[model samples]
Target: MRGFSLLDSSGLPVAKTCFDPANIPEALHLDVWRQASRCGAQVDSLQRDWRFRGRTSNWYTDGVVFSHTLCDATHYQRTPRHIRRGDSDCLVLKLQLAGHQQGIFGDFDHFSSPPGTLVLQDWAIPYNITTTPYEVMAVSIPRYLLRGSHLMYRRNPVITWQPDSPQARLLVPILTQTLKSLATASAGEADAYAAGITGLLDGLLLGDRELLQSKYRERDRLEDMRQYLSRHLSDPDLGADHLCRQFHCSRATVYRLFQREGGIATFILRQRLQRCMQEISRMGVVQKGFLEALAHTWGFSSRANLARHFKAYYGITPQQAVEAARSHQNEGQREMNAPYWRDAHRVSRWLESIAPGASPTEPAGAHGGTRQGPRELAGH
Candidate 1:
């Protein structure tokens, strides 16, 4: 494993690194820092209206990789201008959690990856960024580690990926959720997070590498069953018995597999309605005629059926949900073209008393400074 270091409470690199910075070419440092700065500024602009200000950052490695953050007006221009790229390369995966950004990675390759979009790029390359109103979670890993993996090296070098398929979908949600959890993580959790990341990366590349062979085989069978049902949602005959015969599985086993998602018949109906609703949402609420026809066409069986299920799941009737979704859609579009939107600054003051050094009895306020409320100091 590559040598590593971490941050203490003071947020400083606490280990003696092995990588020699003096050997790095001077030109590369300036270029990397320039892009880092622009990326930092773009994120800061997005978080300007929030109650929170500034971010905590740490940079350390045995010269294998570097990581840092520039929050609280800590712009990227302050980074050193020279770096050695021989022993290792750097890849930065930026997750924009709040705002949107337009960036150009290579001369002709432009990206408009919005909030929830993950951007991957090489740090050795020159990149430019366009700012918007939002913050980001950025991860910088050594290129050598990633490139050494047979999986990553084999894939298209400049591909942008999304978690869409059943097998691949877990990657997106898990990664995003982990990143968010990391923001407030304690020192003890850092190593665990790092291990989880590496394992996940390997699984992503090698296709669920951590699972037992039996589990992997089961997943494949389940995935096939799912796809078959999805493709034939309208068939009333699409029940457990059909699945048992098609997959050569026992009726009990088939029923058990789908039990978690409701029985096989209920699951099929749910999927059909969900698909129909997705199409309706895309067409807009005003397309009332098309919407009704689509429900029946998608195997809802009747308008009442659609309405009942839609309300049960979405808390709104089909017509009302469509209207509400349209309103939400229009609002989102309006915000996109604008420079910024107002963020709600309604942070609860009760957070102060519970801050870092606060006593258990204290009513605490959080999100930076100024503790308020009855204070009973702990660990004093």
Candidate 2:
């Protein structure tokens, strides 16, 4: 029996692995169990007609982001005893491309998913999933990425998106296209797309006014704080007091929102350093006093301070990064002149078009340094 093969955008098989119960008579159930366990969950009980077919394509993103396509015959999967040990603490955003499924999610909530419907299932919870001959495309995202979003705090076992709502109407197609596009997307492109997906989910969660009004004020406050920070990243005076004044929130709330990244001050410092690095990388070889000016622009106290922090964060001084950028400038220009680069440039422009407030111009010096680095494309 030929096994499943993961294909690239060019339709070439990047990975292939076969699992057939027929091939191994000694362990008829081993093949299916292997598939289930290796992925995330466990197949608690397999029906007599149980058959499994699955393929996974992982995209290069900030965390464990991947698309798993499966066509399974009849099966029941659960998170039991030792099964729970493998919990990934991730969320599976399953899009029913074909067929249907019904399951008890989050212990109490039951859901039926049909074609075009989107369902979000948290891997941290105990649940049972039952499906017939069904085909599904599921994107697995790390839960922490959605930590501050209201959806992450929802008690619902599974959040399902029907085609009826305005949000679903807009979200479903974007997700479907994103899943389809990942096959061809470069690592840098995939990172950008993954961020787009996260932004969409955040919007979906925040758009639910009823849910937000229930008891999610803290989540809203966090979201607001994040937006304020983004806009004020270059503000040297930005701090807990500024956040408190702008958002009318306490200093504790400001600290809590940024706790995962460090404290509020640390988060701000990191952001400034990141911006400085980007600016330095883009300018390549800078003119006299350029470093000092860039540092001030990004809110660094001084060029020396920026250089120290930049070296610590990126393992190279800002001057080294500028020199590297200059060295690769010609090569980047030649690559940008290529057909593929033109295509990529057009795609980047299109992305910026769709994302309001996104800069249409490619970041300066992006052409030279590690062309497809995730961190490089992350700013795009």
Error of 1 at 331 (Å): 4.3
lDDT of each: 0.41, 0.53
Q: Can you give the TM-score per candidate against the true fold? A: 0.38, 0.46
Per-residue lDDT over 63-105 for candidate 2, one digit per residue giving the tens place of the 0 to 100 score:
4345544544333444544233443445667878776776555
State the number of backbone clashes in model 2: 0
| lDDT digits (tens) for residues 1-380 of candidate 1 | 23223443544222211112242232222222222333222111111111122232332222221232222211121111212212113445565555555543322223455656666554443334434334665554444334223222212112244434443355456655655565455433444454455445544544633422332345457667877787777774577877888899999888777664557776676666556644654464365476567666777767887788766654456676455434333221222221111100001111111123211112112122331222221111
Return the lDDT, model 2, position 82.
28
Number of the top TM-score candidate: 2
The collision pairs in model 2 are: none
Cα lDDT of candidate 2 equals: 0.53
